[model samples]
Target: MGVFKLPWSLLKDINKVMRNFWWGQVEEERKIHWVSWKTMGKLKTAGGMGFRESHSFNLAMLAKQGWKLLHHPQALASLVLKAKYFPHSEFFQAKLGSKPSFIWRSIMDARELVKRGTRWRVGNGEAIKIWEDKWVPKLPYAKIMSPVRVLSPEAFVSILIDPGTKQWKTSMVEDLFLPEEATLIKQIPISFNNSPDKLIWSGCMAPVLKETSKMFLPKPTIKNLIKELEDSGGKELVEEFAVVARRDAAVDRIQCKIGIGLIIRDWNGRVVATSRKFRPLFPDPLLAEAMGAIEASCFGLQLGIKRIILEGDSKIVISAINNREENWSAMGMLIEDVKIKLNSYEEWSASHVRREGNQAAHKLARDALLHSISSVDMGIISHCIHDCN
Candidate 1:
């Protein structure tokens, strides 16, 4: 399927056979499907069985190859294709020349999928067309929704950038875009070095440095659980070896700055680890809380904790993670990352708590804004929290 596009009729027949097998159809007898193939093909976290539909899967695989061609233009395959099919133009501008080969046609057909998933990371912004390219990170399709009226439709993103300070031209942005759009555009971080614009995938972009080390600890027995409860004043005890992670976010709405605080405890309520990080330009508190959870998950991986009980102050974010629903909003990608991390553990659960129950994490979050520091030992945790056994 990656080499050539399969016919729709063939794909349809393939789906029919798979559906029949799943529904227990005999030689001549058929049973009710009960569920649609489309529903069954959705991700498991989205309440489906995680099946892949053949045609769309084929297109995705082909799109990946097309993506490689665009990013790796100097590769042997790309050079050969460009020399023959688009000698006078780049891949994006290439035409379906006379008698195109099956491979060329297959790749070209998948370009739309690649385009839909691509977004531009603004730098000097000189290379990006303000109205034509997807440079506005917060907007749908990463493009301005307002029609081309304030500025010329041919304007480049550089026109809105202040070269003197390498920051956004605030007054110009307000005059050019809607009030909300202007705010969002300013929140986007600008490169001070005048770097060129770069294309990026908007979906499934995980942290650049992913932790690959694995550490699995032995599960504690009932006797150990009882002993831990006794040592910790019988509060928040679990049935087995578990790590409780309390997370909170401190928000400075006026400055668009946020601090994420995380406290990880053993089943006995001993502070095993704590993390505090400072981030900039988070639009809302919910997003900050979600980001805090992502950091907490990473911290847990660093500490080699496999079983976790995640607690947070935001009910909305906790519910979203626990329910595992399909999120299509701006924070969708963050939520997906948290879910993926938790699913890797042997057992993990998320629950909501009131601010009062998460005060220690709240304090850490506030401190993160004032001081940028991290603690793997009890140094910071001991000072911030006194209930550790």
Candidate 2:
């Protein structure tokens, strides 16, 4: 196949002068090695101008056969594979991949047909013939591919892949591997006239034609995935991912329930650090703690007070981050923001204290609601709900 890429002008000519001209063209003009047989254009019996690259053509054809046998197998390769490895099974496995998925096993069966190598017979102690006379009815494949034979449509579909090996791989070998190559072979496009002289068509004498198999694309759309989620055990994770996906847009404190272990500090007035029923929401807790840190730092910046400790029992709330996800997704972002705010202060850190240790914030929260609704300025926390008709 790579040989086809060689320039047409470089093709060896019949006459000595013509061959020299071709070689000179490459050496002086194109500047290439242009090596060749000293003698050119042999008779029909000898098979030469008439110059067939017997070895390269053989290899490329074999490679094509190997490619085809790997994917689709109805040829001698299939028979060989069946006789040796997968006598009763639909697929064979290589030593490295003995345990593979069922889907992979099915694909393996296709590859097996292309690389149907032989094996020794177990009982009788003789190598069983993968290709036998019974398999070929008077070289049915050879007749179609044979230049000597009369033209037959049946011949067009089959070819003797390895005439020397007597390994007649099934037709349509190029179709299997070329399409895979096409997917990877990206380049500038060139116009083609679909001439028989084209190397693509030269495979007519061989078994395989360019493949036309429609690749089976996966059809399970997102809707199908949703259906799968409904039944799959990992549905919770999928649901959680969905929740996290909401963070890009939604702007609300997502609902969360939390464990509470409240404590209060000095009865006099350690009221700045406070906690309440809606307290455990992380980022909120973290933010509150961060606010405490900022304020504690401010004391040094403003009044130059040295001793300071900002503490919070509400680990979740003090995190001061909001995320659609129930986890600490918002914590990192919030922490960074809080850290920047705290930098204004001289020194302070938000400490996570046990409920027993965090009495100051806890007590402030308890005392905050201790006032009677009717007595003190009751409108402080109250707002009217307007009903618009």
Give the per-residue lDDT digits (tens) of candidate 2, residues 159-221.
423334322232333333233222211110111111111111111211221245222211224
Worst 10 residues of 1 by lDDT: 209-218
Candidate maximizing TM-score? 1
Which candidate tops lDDT?
Answer: 1
lDDT of 2 at 186: 14
- Residues 1-389, model 1: lDDT tens digits: 88888999998998888888888847688679898999999999997888879899889988988888877889999999999999888667888889999999999999899889988767688878988888776588788887788778899999999999977898988888887788778876565457567666766332222144222222324346557678887554453557799989888877677788888877666677777788665547766887788888878877788788889998777766755344444454566678777767776777789998898898888888666555455424546555533
Segments of candidate 2 deviating more than 4 angstroms: 1-307, 315-328, 366-389
**Poorly placed runs, candidate 1 (over 4 Å):** 25-28, 149-151, 208-389
Model 2 reaches what TM-score against the true structure?
A: 0.20
Supply the global lDDT for candidate 2: 0.31
